[model samples]
Target chain A: SAVISQKPSRDICQRGTSLTIQCQVDSQVTMMFWYRQQPGQSLTLIATANQGSEATYESGFVIDKFPISRPNLTFSTLTVSNMSPEDSSIYLCSVGTGGPNYGYTFGSGTRLTVV
Target chain B: AQSVTQPDIHITVSEGASLELRCNYSYGATPYLFWYVQSPGQGLQLLLKYFSGDTLVQGIKGFEAEFKRSQSSFNLRKPSVHWSDAAEYFCAVGAAKLIFGTGTRLQVFP
Candidate 1:
């Protein structure tokens, strides 16, 4: 499993501000996933980041609101743009080892709070 | 479409008691099942996973899960509970895109 280091474990911002969360992996991986876990809710996939290409966003998620950048195999960043109270959630980054037998590793997660 | 269901929202157990958390999933094709535990202020940790093999699988921290294909269930179990085992448990299905169930929060008491 890959180890991920996520920055800004938590943060509080104004309603109109934006916050960018970062994840750096200790090993190079083919794919990196971003997820949002709303309070008292199950985790939801936001987007999938692959090196050298634009991210693939989930149906409910838009690149405009949740832009993802994968500059390289070991680094990725997710930005929550034009934040609102409703956008408050815990964001997580993960990397899978490529099969059902191997599980994925997740970052500690960033707890975002919008005022 | 793939989905996961965790029937229990919260479970309480005494420190030496046995524990079981139920999870059911719906997916087409060969399903990949996983159980993850998340402690407060920490990241999600993989407890166990089932891809292909025997139904019974053992995981770290004395946790085990049995995969029942006919029932589409992968329930987690432990012979004895510990206060440190208190956390949120999530059941997910998929290899590339994971569909997670609403987690079950375990409350362990001495």
Candidate 2:
């Protein structure tokens, strides 16, 4: 098991502003992912951040909307650019090791409310 | 395309009662299945997962699930419910890129 933490556990921002959420893991992990949970909806994968490489985004998600940065094995940041009320929701970061079947550990999540 | 489905939107259960949450998936191949719990104002925590062999998998916090390949289902169950168990539960499939279901919100009453 690993202890994961996110900064700005909860935040409220004005529309058109951008916020960068930070994810730090207690130990080094190979795979770090960013997810978005819309109000009353399921979570959607935003992208996968790997050290020394650009993030891999899902079909509906793009780097321009959600820019990601992975500077090391244990840390990653996701910047929600051009925020809107629709972007108000919980953002989660999960860390996992690659394999056929493996477990995932997630940060407590950042609750963002864009007004 | 890979997708996960959690049919139930909200489930209310009395405390100390048994509980079961339904989930189903559609994928091209044998898929990895997982159950995760998210308390209000908290990130999601892994409840259990099934990747292969064992059809039944045990998870922390007294949660268990069984995988049915024929039905494309992985359902979560608990013998007795606790008020603390009131939270949102999500079912996910796929290993590299997890596709999560809409989620089931569990409500517990005294």
lDDT values, one for every candidate: 0.93, 0.90
lDDT of 1 by residue, B20-58 (tens): 999999999899889999998788999998898899999
Per-candidate DockQ versus the true complex? 0.86, 0.89
lDDT of 1 by residue, A2-99 (tens): 88999889999999899999999998888799999999888999999989999999999999999999999999999999999999999999997764
Off by over 4 Å in 2: A99-101
Which residue pairs clash in candidate 2? Answer: A108-B43
Candidate 2 global TM-score:
0.94
Docking quality category of candidate 2 according to DockQ thresholds: high
- Highest lDDT model number: 1
Error of 1 at A61 (Å): 0.4
- Residue B16 in model 2: shift from native, Å? 2.1
- Candidate 1's error at A78, in angstroms? 0.2
Measured against the true structure, the TM-scores of the candidates, in listed sequence, are 0.97, 0.94
Per-residue lDDT tens digits for candidate 2, residues A25-114, read 988888999988887777888999979999999888889989999999999999999998999989989988665546788888898999
Best by DockQ: 2
The alpha-carbon lDDT assigned to residue A45 of candidate 1 equals: 96
